[model samples]
Target: MNELLLTGDERDRAGARLLALLDSYERGLPKAEILPEPDRDVLASLLAAPMPERGVGVDALFDRWEDTILPNSTAVAHPRFLAYVLGPPNGIAPYAEAVAAALNQNCNFWQLSPAASVVERSVLEWLASVVGFPAQAKGILTGGGSLATLQALATALNDRVPDFHANGLQRASAPLVVYTSVEAHRSVDKAAAILGIGLDNVRHIATDSVHRMDVGALRAAIEEDRADGLRPWCVVATCGTVSTGSVDPLDDIADLCAAEDLWLHVDGAYGALFLLSEEMRGLMGGCARADSITLDPHKLLYASLEAGCLLVRDGAKLRDAHAFDSSYLTVAEDPLMTDYMDYGPQLSRNFKAFKVWSALQAFGVSAFREANVRTLGLARRLGEGIEATPGLTLLAPVTLTAVCFAVDGASDDDHTALLERLAAENVALLGPVVVAGRRGIRACVTNHRTSEADIDLVLEWLQSRLTGRR
Candidate 1:
């Protein structure tokens, strides 16, 4: 037996300590600082220290965590943490994560993790159902939305370019071009650059007045690219742009993709899961028509960090793009389970599906749907507050949970200072955004913990600040 293995007593003590720590953290979340101040000296000491030759024991390690680590960590679960598209983890996330770690199941192959593979399949099936994809749709859990989009592009490349696996992009005669709105996430550009689809080939088409990708502009751009001897390979539509939470016209985009023989990849990372609400389905159901779609459970489903999904309309295309056979890792296929290694880049994958599955099983789907509905209501409330305020101006339509507004006569510097002041004062954490060359502040009410009181509190503070400034 390994000497590092803890005895029963030691394990008990460690478990007790960890449970206590978690309990304290949970109890304090409502009152904790949204962003903690770092102790520079302690941080520097940690950076300068070398790894200890021997273990410090569980008790000492737990003490170190409470003293040095916990104080410096951001309280992302705080009710007032409204910055970015991130949300607080669901109530059962920690337990699920701990159980997953304890199992330490390698999800690459069914032989190595049979139960995990089934669980992952179940999760994917539910996600596919949520998007209204056909029974033949298939997917894999990814690191995040960015990786999902990357994998989707890779799959599209394989489908569009003949012999892509054997000759990777080097033999293509015409440059492949991708079309997306200027409001699309940067991940698309990053993926294109990484996949050797030169940046110049990406057309950042203009958006309409409401910030959605203009289908007319997209069609014209594709035609222009074809005239310029570029192969219009794919169209990436945003299902909730990061800046303004504007969802592109997916149905129109899908129609164009079909007409042009282009792959349609929807970057639905920030807003896809809103389909949980029957009301949102009308706006986002068109995602099901895309050749592929990216969804971030971490953002919408409130799963712990590092859980994203990629769904392909045609399962075979995804397998064709990524599947590879190796003699050493030969494992017979089982009808009951999926070998996730044949799906994406990683061969030693963690069991990310467990947390997502556990959260759904624990809270039920209706709970999430209600929570999302509440967030949408809160965003609308915030938008109304902004409009009612004297100096605040709504930068874009409050189409989803993200509310972007500009302070009249405030420059970029003023917004920066306002954000800093708000953070320093523990009012709320809002992110900076740029919309159509105008700088502003963005509040994304994706956190389920956020209440109407919290929204009113922040709005009242802003209104008071503006009043004092005048």
Candidate 2:
């Protein structure tokens, strides 16, 4: 008998157990604690456990998962899990993930994973169409937004820097500078530093009142860098900033990039997929004009974790940046398939696109659109409630699904205490933010399970707790 393979009867039993587990979890999620209090003894026992010479039967394994693991894990899928941009996986995610694991497609090459290659390409095409990219556009699924941004910057360097593939930064006469807004994610700076661009070469431009990148400041900074004999290479714009969900001025920035001949990479990992909503198209349409953009499928698409994408307007440039020849790996190109090894850095990539495509196929696009629209409405509801309350202040506009607000005259310590109390009482799991130097709480309604009632319940609890404290 194969040591690793399960017997037919055992497989059947495991499948039934998995289905029961999923059903029970979904049914009990609402009543469960958003964050569970871990038992120290149980954790200690788990850590002290050693590898057994004999295998524990599948039945016993399932028992351990249900009795110990399930109770200790955070209920991230809970409707009131409003902490970050994270959203729970859709109903079909777990099934799709299991199928993908069983198939084990190595999506790096066309020969090894023909169907996976087609699936990924089709998914990318659909995404590009949503972003209004032309037919020539090409992209690859990534680990997440951070890696996507890093890959985009690397592509920019390969295209802009003289002899980049041959000599890299060593041949440059002066330092090359990258510009982004002060509100941009830390991934931008991290990408630059990793690419040998150095933190000193990155310019954090000022922002406007609504927390968008100040275009004037960005333009002036670019010119100033040129005047100082520094090479201005790329501009990283944000579609939705982390704190306030503010979108940078994409049209104006695209125009500036055109005039300046600089690469424009929009970090839309948090908000680009909002384009599914007809209402968001006008605000996020500028994504099409970018040379490259990053998107996180796990965020808006509600796929399982670690699903991201990087799209490049000029598909040839992306390949030019990373493609290398190897005798053992070389194969005749097929017209219908993409050799993903030429697209990005990975050569042993998994089938990350299957989960995304499966969900879209299972639920259709309209379902996601409706869910996004609902989240937007719920955010507006929460914002209005906060504004109407006597002791609360809306720190920033409800741009997307993130509602940032502060308690009137509340100290940072007080805000921290309030957040802890809310989590401990299981009212909601909100995140903390500092908007324009004021410490505040942020409730991001990204979960599809979130409802009008959930929003109202959180508001009522907050109002009661802060009734006279204001």
Candidate 3:
């Protein structure tokens, strides 16, 4: 037998060693540096090295991981790192991720992964219920919001065009047009361009003063497209814009799509999960009106990377866009078992749903809701703190968890320096946002790990920096 196949004694020793390393990680978790600068030369050498021709034993591999991989990666889990729309993984996430990997469930079809199939369907059904989608709603878990939006547009194309799959973009008789606000995520334009909808046809409709999509501009754009002999096919609305966290007027946009006989897709990837909190239901009530929606559980639900979802009101349409007969992988769709391959593009898929579902099951929905509510409240508090400070000016309305602000009398350079200084000092890791033509430091308090104390600390750091500049 090959030495690679470990005997009973070897297996036991390896297991014990692994346990010790994991225990150290668990014990040192709290004291670990929030952000550690990496030795890039060492990292580069490891990355550039040829895949070793010979096997490195587990003991050696773990040592390399502790010294290299763990330190080089960004520590998004640090409560003080308030940048971007990312969330720290829930406590159960790592364990669930390991379990899913061990099981190695191919979540494509029911027979291949019976429990995974049921788990995925169950998760989708629950998400649909939260969005108030009816019994006919269906969805597939995706890598992230961008992929979900892209897939949604693909489904819309299949539904609207008579021969999209058969003769894609070959005929130019009536070109399709897509409409979205200027503040919408770039994913909308990307999808249109990929679908051969033509960049010129994508109308970046004007936004209102607060950055909500202008309903009137949308109407005029559709009319202008019709007059110009262009096909107005769909509308992509944002629940929370990437820059200022503005929610495009979803109800009005949905009405326009209906009037124009076009598909309505809501990019709710960042904001939709906020629906879990009772405080956010009214603000995001319009999501239910969308024919299709994209949501990111990884961002808000605190699942590890790569857990996003796309829900369609008419779930059958998702299958319509993607389903194709494959003789080798045939399995009749059983009511009890969902053949997820029919729902989206992939036939071989990892069991992503289990990680998300496991988190929800372990924490319960109410805990997530409370944590989201707290994050929202903290953002508002930080915004208020910025407004109260004499030198700091609010850059945008704190509509959600993103707080954008600029230090008074500070040039763009000053603002950038301040941000970098805070990050380097381990005070906080915030990002930048651009509104109209002006740029400012932005903090997205989306992590459940963050608290009011962390926000106050960041605020104090900003105050001291502002004082020093004077």
Cα lDDT of all candidates, in order? 0.94, 0.95, 0.88
Instruction: Give a tens-digit lDDT track for model 1, residues 340-434.
Output: 99999999999999999999999999999999999999999999999999889999999999999999999899999999999999889999998
* Per-residue lDDT value at 264 in model 1: 98
Off by over 4 Å in 1: none
Q: What is the TM-score (0 to 1) of candidate 2?
A: 0.98
Query: Model 3 over residues 240-328: C-alpha lDDT tens digits?
Result: 88888899888888888888899999999889889998777877889999989999999889989999999999998999999898898
After TM-score superposition, the amount by which residue 203's alpha carbon in candidate 3 deviates from its true location, in angstroms, is 1.1
lDDT per residue, candidate 2, 138-192, as tens digits?
Answer: 9999999999999999999999987899998887388999999999999999999
Relative to the true structure, candidate 2 has a C-alpha RMSD (angstroms) of 1.2
Candidate rank order under lDDT = 2, 1, 3
Ten contiguous residues minimizing lDDT sum, candidate 2: 461-470
Clashing pairs in 3: none
